[model samples]
Target: MAFTTVPLTALGAAPWEPNTTYQTGDIVTYGTDTYQCVQGHTSLVGWEPPNVPALWSKQSSPADTQPPTAPADVIASNVTSSTVTLTWTASTDNVGVTGYDVYNGSAVAGSSATTSYTVTGLSASTAYTFTVKAKDAAGNVSAASAPVNVTTGAPVVDTEPPTAPNNLTAPTVTTSSVSLSWTASTDNIGVAGYDIYNGTTLAGSSNTTFYTVTGLTANTSYTFTVKAKDAAGNVSTASNALTVTTLPQNSTQYEIIGYFPSWAAYDSPSFTPSNIDSSKVTVINYAFLDICWNGRHGNPSQSPDNPNPNTWTCQNGDGTVNNAPNGSIVLGDSFTDGTADGGYNQLVKMRQLKNTNPNLKLFASVGGWTWSNQFSNTANDPVTRGNFATSAVNFLRQYQFDGIDIDWEYPNSIGVPCASGQTCQRTADKANYVLLLQTLRQALDTAGQQDGKHYYITIASSANSSFLADAGGTSNWLSNAAQYLDWINIMTYDYYGPWDAASGIVSPLYNDPANTNGNSQFNINSTVTNYLNKGLPANKLTIGEPFYGYGWKGCNAGPNNNGLYQSCSGEATGGSDGSTYDFAYMQNTGLLSADSTGKYTIAGQGYTRYWNSVTQTPFLYNPSTKIFITYDDEQSVHLKNEFIKTKGLRGAMFWELNADRNRTLQSIVSNDLPH
Candidate 1:
């Protein structure tokens, strides 16, 4: 080997040259072998990697020669519009897996020390494919995990606005509020709600077509518009503008309410609106409007030969006629095109009567004893309640009514027979009745905003415990329903009638202790006291006096206790409807008269009049004829009027407008009660 001293370069190994520094763990090749530096040193001529065993050592075979196996069970979850989380089973490496590399279509999207990674900043509404790779300390990555596919969600975008509402109008306008309504708007999405604008400023909003914009200046003119909006924040153009001027505040003290039965226009001794003495009463309630099973407002169809043309004629669901009379009367004015009948024509005549008495207000009373069968159904659901309210508004506007009166007789109790496929009672009727009143109040308020006037609502309440308990469960119905109503007409009469086997005073101001077989709480005084004790404000209560009287024949007659609470063989004779006679009929026919002592006397009619000081009511007895008449005469009416003022009640109401032909009783009410 010493023959020529050949250089290490000739042996095919790079020569270790002088002046080249090497650091620890530096790898180099010499004489077909790889070596690593053990210490920092400069190269020498004879100290080659092969010759210097103590200073250099050949690098051993490479460790971790195999890369990790492909990750298993890769999944993408928790995906959102802009982000997704990825997870995978741990990969197996020849050594051990240290970390993971997440990829998006072969490009490194992210890295993770564990098996899961959350990738963010992803495009919305875009499709994407992802994978996972495993790497060891040697930096040898495995193949991508089974290709996983995903797509980001679409972006939330709102571009369409609701259409402009049409027919913007006000139903009622008051000193401080305007009731507005319009046709609802349309949208690609659903219209969420509406905003009412008063001269370009938002005054209120409503989910429905109706809205009441309050807090306005009294006696001021206001311009209003409506705008429709969607959930996406888009809004439509403003609706047509409407201008309204509010009315001055009302300062009336007393309320004199009268009932005008639509059928009265067609009945014998026909009492039309022309007969109404406007100065005798400040308000007239038109009776009545009915609800059909289909949620439409209905009244009796006019029949030329029905005698009472306004009387309702019952119709089956199939449109077939029935023997039962239709108990509802549609106002003749409800029809357009000159087809209006005497009923509607009478209503028009009444509406015009307001010009003579500017303080007079008229309302349409809906639901009565015979037509109340559908009240429970109408008020049980929101849809039906809405329909009923809309129809009520339409009816009021069409007839120029000043308000509405809901006369649902004895809710949660039986009235007349229900129409076919109709429900008359429910346990929920109490609460639903309140809801019905609330709906009507809201609708009425909205309507009142447009008309520039205050609208009123009243209820004809029963005078018994059953009516209260059934309506609100120990809570006074007046307490629950009074705020929405202008007044409650308490039917203080009707304590006893032919419905009772024994006769009693029809309307006693106080309890009668004379051999009583009836309820002690049935009299007017007890009824009013009960209501007042149960949280009814005296000012909101109007005592109801019957213009008619209940008659019983074949009863014991005496000066003591008269025929009160006496055994009656049957109903009295000579009543058009049987068992009842109007004040007019009694006086005109000389069945009742006033004695010299200012007491009502049976006088030459084979009847004797007796006064019950304890009950403060009068009854007529006929010993030979065995007839008894219980009624309120002018003296009794005067006494009741004094009682109203003493008790600080609002006023009094009569069951009818046509009953007192001579206004004998009305004269007392008009003069005795506060005007």
Candidate 2:
């Protein structure tokens, strides 16, 4: 690109920095009078009175006589209405003519070089003073004209309100107020003001178009009139009034008021929902209660670990016992182990649930698969058992649970943790387990007397062979423990697994018929029967349904495929190790899916899998690739709920609440559980 020389005149002075271009001001007499430059830019000359930087000076130009002074004028006319008429003469300018400034009591009200201006928005029957000043392009403001006071005539009354708003309505809404934004109005001086009448009484007035009338009775009808006023203080004849009713009183309005560790951004005030209505849900479950394993407990200053819940000096001997000495406990524990600090995430959720649902009750669960070491010792000896029971009481008192739920993996040899205890090391661990329950019952009873409330005791037992002993025989242990417990929650999900010799259905309606051992086990019917056969009252048993599923491995596809699902057959992809994917992740990542038949599915290894409604289970099968996948979904949940209702079961408890915190499984379960 070649450069071309440009003439100076071709371009206007360098663009003035916006707003920096100063308007004309008084001349500065420094040695000799120096004219003020329109641009704030400096015009250097010998300094006479070194002043502040803003006072720039330039030699006076012959063309600069004080620019035309603003012309003076007054608001005229006898109209005593909402509108006022103002008139002023054009200001004389040396260069030519420009505009005039009309003031309403020293404030700019109207402007023009013409002789008249209709100032709207004046109050009806109000008095106002206005003055005018003329200005020329050179930036000279003329002296204000003499003030002219004017009084508006009495406003014409619009006793006949403008046509009332048509079809005004206050639909039974749940919002904060009923808005009264209305249609526009016409007037002689234009609608200067609008008077809003609520049921014939003046509520207020606004110059603008819309208004929201608040604090009105719900489900009640009221009439409203919006009247317009003009510049002459003449009020328009009232628009026809409109009638509308307010929403019916919030009959069922309610609010969610509880907290859990998992509540996103709960530590901040902004986490609350913008619009809340309490009437939608007949019941609510706040979600958590920390029973044991208090890791993140209380606030930053006071915590269980800092003071310890187990410092009581009165030792219940049998050195194996762990006592809760302080009696003070907290909510939330670390992920794996039970500690002195606080309860776990599970407890937090339970507490929150109770807060939302006033009629709801919460229970603390003790001894999961990971914490079974204390069971055998507590079960065998009365002293150690007493300590355990006392600890349970202390926990309940501190955390506010309705009861305690015992989740021992098994009474005898089943899980690995209970394998080596000196107390009841034999295969006959069942009898010892019963003793433990009796001790808990007695202790809870004693504590209940002191607290004025009887505490409930429930157990979560395995539905598999281990709890039942060899040959599917009911353990004599149940007969002993039944009297002390409120109910038993039987876990029926993980009955079948890769632990079996072949890769087959982990949770099935029936054991694989092809099993050579004639093992007709692992079905909902069988599990329910097992509990009932063991002397359990149907009304005192709650079936446990899994929100997640287990996976298996090792299978191939061919003309005649083996019973093992080929997709699940590929080297064991590994089921969750105590941590299954949750619905929170499903919603956040948009990965949730429900089949047409209402089965839930998630993509795995190139195969589409569906849960079985009849079995309350899931399975996958890729016929082309010969794969099988299955997981639990709404269909499966429905089947499980039916089992609870038909069998007259107390209710159902999911393994963990977090798995479906977003309510995927809960929505289904809620429909099935007793109201």
> In terms of TM-score, which candidate is strongest?
1
Task: Report, for every candidate in turn, its global Cα lDDT versus the true structure.
Answer: 0.70, 0.49
lDDT (Cα, tens digit) per residue for candidate 2, span 232-255: 465655666677776674322221
* Candidate 1, superposed: residue stretches over 4 Å from native: 1-252, 295-344, 419-421, 470-477, 558-561, 595-602
TM-scores, all models, native as reference: 0.60, 0.48
Please identify model 2 stretches exceeding 4 Å from their true place: 1-352, 417-424, 469-475, 510-518, 558-571, 574-592, 595-605, 610-616, 622-627
Top candidate when judged by lDDT against the true structure:
1
Model 1's TM-score against the true structure: 0.60
lDDT of 1 by residue, 1-675 (tens): 112232333344344554465544456787666775543455655556644432455554445568889999999999877789899999887755646789998687866656788888899989999999887644688888898899998766779999999999877665556667799899985798999899978876677787666556668999999999997789999999999998774433578888887656434455778887888888888876566442123322222211111222233222233232112223322321012221135556778788888889998887776556667766766655776677677667777888888788768885554432234677777777876776887777777667766678888988986776744352555466664566789989988887777888888899877745888898899889988887676767899988888888878764464676788888885654567888888887777776787545655577777777877777777778777888888778888888888887878988888888677777778777655
